[model samples]
Target: MAPSFGIMTAPSQVDYADVLRVWREADTVPEIEHAWLFDHLMPIFGDPAGPTYEGWTLLSALAAHTRRLRLGVMVTSNRFRPPALLAKIATTVDIVSGGRLDFGIGVGSRPSHPLARREYDAHGLPFHDAAYAVAGLAEACTLIRRLWTEDEPFDFHGTQHRLTGAFGSPKPVQRPHPPILIGGRSSATLRVAAEHADIWNIPGGDIDDVTRRSALLDRYCKDIGRDPANLTRSIHLPVSYDRPGDTRAAIREAIDAGFRHLVLGLPAPYPADVARWTADELIGPSA
Candidate 1:
């Protein structure tokens, strides 16, 4: 199957409401199966002082405004929110969007900032340890899935998270639950995604790296007696420019390499412009 392509709508210093207008416009255009937004409290790239929009709020807005586009956080940090709460939020958003939600989560790589840096100190957690982060994220995913799918009350006791007597109301519109997409580029993340994720997204890995990691993931899936094909493979491209010519060649190459989805990162301040431009020049025309 030809891989599907989508846009990443990372908010800049621009007003939140305005971005929604652009997102609605972009959503109306064909060839965009999904629209992803970054989940961060502060700007990770571009100007350090540049404005950063929160991911979940933007996703909620997208859910309310758009009809066809699958809206989700490109990858939200599991460290920030309690797993149970995240599950409930995902369900609520799924309901709001009439079943168009993808919960893309990751062990965040960005360094902590001052305003929100206290979260680490509060939890007595090490901010930069990738191993610890991956473990915690895995535990969180386990808890979330249980909360979403189990009929009776369940208990989740883990070193990083513990939940008891939690019941989520009005299960997500998607059967079972909204698809879970695990994001990151590491052995731990690959193993976690192989074990649990419905989809796997890698932000900026090369094709060789992606192929190698995907093979590992398939091995893990097969070992567990699960069909590896059930797991969707997605690529998150960085700083893509939709120049003249076959601008979609990159997307096609990723598709040929076995990816099912392509999430393009939009440059700041003009994210909508870039997204719309890409759609008009590349996605719409090609489709």
Candidate 2:
């Protein structure tokens, strides 16, 4: 089978128009399966109020323009939107795309990043303890999945979210909902992915790093009686436009290391020549 590939339109300073251009161009390529965005209310770096369009809204708009491409965030910050509403939005996007949706999500607010904390502070969102974050993510995974698949309304009670007779209507177009890609590298994260995710997404790393982490995820899968083979492994690769060969090498290596899906990142305002090269050299043959 051909390798599945996707792109992350750099979520920084680029205007939404250029992003729409990229997404439209990328969707026409058979090699490109999906386009991803980051869930951030504020800029990840530089100015906090940078020109970052909302991820969900962007996907919603992109859905109207594209034909075959799937839409998703690299991993939505679960705290950025409430669980049930998030599920509703995702289902709507899936419907719009005619089942072309890959629903990726993760907990919000990284402890190591002060900017994330600052973003949360500015928005009055809590940066909770690690335990709370992990447990909440697990519960969220369960709730969202249920919301997408359940026929009857159900009450849900969890440490971070509670719903009474939650009636998530218009179930997703994909059976049992779209594939959920769980993100993060910590042990808690791996465990949650093993239990709930159809795909496991981690930041791109060297061959040895991918090997080591793949083994770790396998262990987590077995501990819970889930087969590791059932989970699709993906890497988020940050590529430099000047280093095309480096991008190809990393992608080839990741493919050799058993990663089936790639989340690719290009520089903002991707140059025309570079984008063409990405399509011809990197993505075309892989597909």
Candidate 3:
């Protein structure tokens, strides 16, 4: 199958108008099949005091402004919100977008990054060890899916979370719920993705590393008796406005490595008509 392309605007250090403008423009461009936002409570890049909009809130607003592009947070941090609440929030966005939601989630950010770790303390959210985070992620995935698909209220008892009389009313617009796209390159995450994710995404930089991770995902899928091909491979590549050729090269390499779903990450302080520039300068030549 031919590859599909999309754009991601990290909601940091940029105003709402800027993001809305890009999404509105990308909505008119058929070559751009989807749009995304990253989930981070504080600025991971740029000045520490810079403005950063909460991801799902911004996504819901953007979803209302655009008509066509499939939209989602690149990968929501499972630690930021309870699984049941997230299920409802995702459902609302899907409804607002008229069913054009791609549900992306992960085990949250690793504590190793100082910038990322500070958010947990700043926001009073717990910072668990890697094993705990991955296990919680797996349980969250199972619970969230049930919340999206089950017809009646149900109770969930898991090591990480528990709920009683839980149910999602007005379930997501997408039948069987929106496609769950889990992002991460960790083996534990790959195992969860193999079981729960319809689409799997990882950041692009080292093509060989991502290719190896993809192979491991395939093995995990087979171990569980699931066909590896059933899960779509997705990658996020940063777009360099100064060097469109370099961006195109990365896109081509990712495609060569079997990533059919590509998300081109647009840096902040976007140029005028950036979406058009992306289509003309990067995507057009690459195709």
* TM-score against native, each model: 0.88, 0.95, 0.99
Model 1: CA > 4 A from native? 110-128, 239-247, 271-276, 284-287
lDDT computed for candidate 3: 0.94
Q: Tell me how many clashing residue pairs each candidate has.
A: 0, 0, 0
**Residue pairs with clashing backbones, model 2:** none
Cα lDDT of model 2 by residue, 74-186, tens digit: 88988777888999999999998899889999877687886777777778877788878888889989999999888998998787798999988899999978999999888
Clashing pairs in 1: none
- Best-fitting candidate, scored by TM-score: 3
Q: What is the C-alpha lDDT of each candidate?
A: 0.78, 0.84, 0.94
Candidate 3 residue 282 C-alpha distance from true site, Å: 1.2
Cα lDDT tens digits, model 3, 154-267, are 988899898999988989999988999999999989999999999999999889999999999999999999999999999999999999889999999999999999999999
lDDT, model 1, position 270: 57
Per-residue lDDT tens digits for candidate 1, residues 32-150, read: 77888877666555565767776887788779988998878978888768788889889989999999999999987545444445435545645757778888888988888888888
Ranking by TM-score: 3, 2, 1
Kindly give the stretch of ten consecutive residues in candidate 2 with the minimal lDDT sum: 269-278
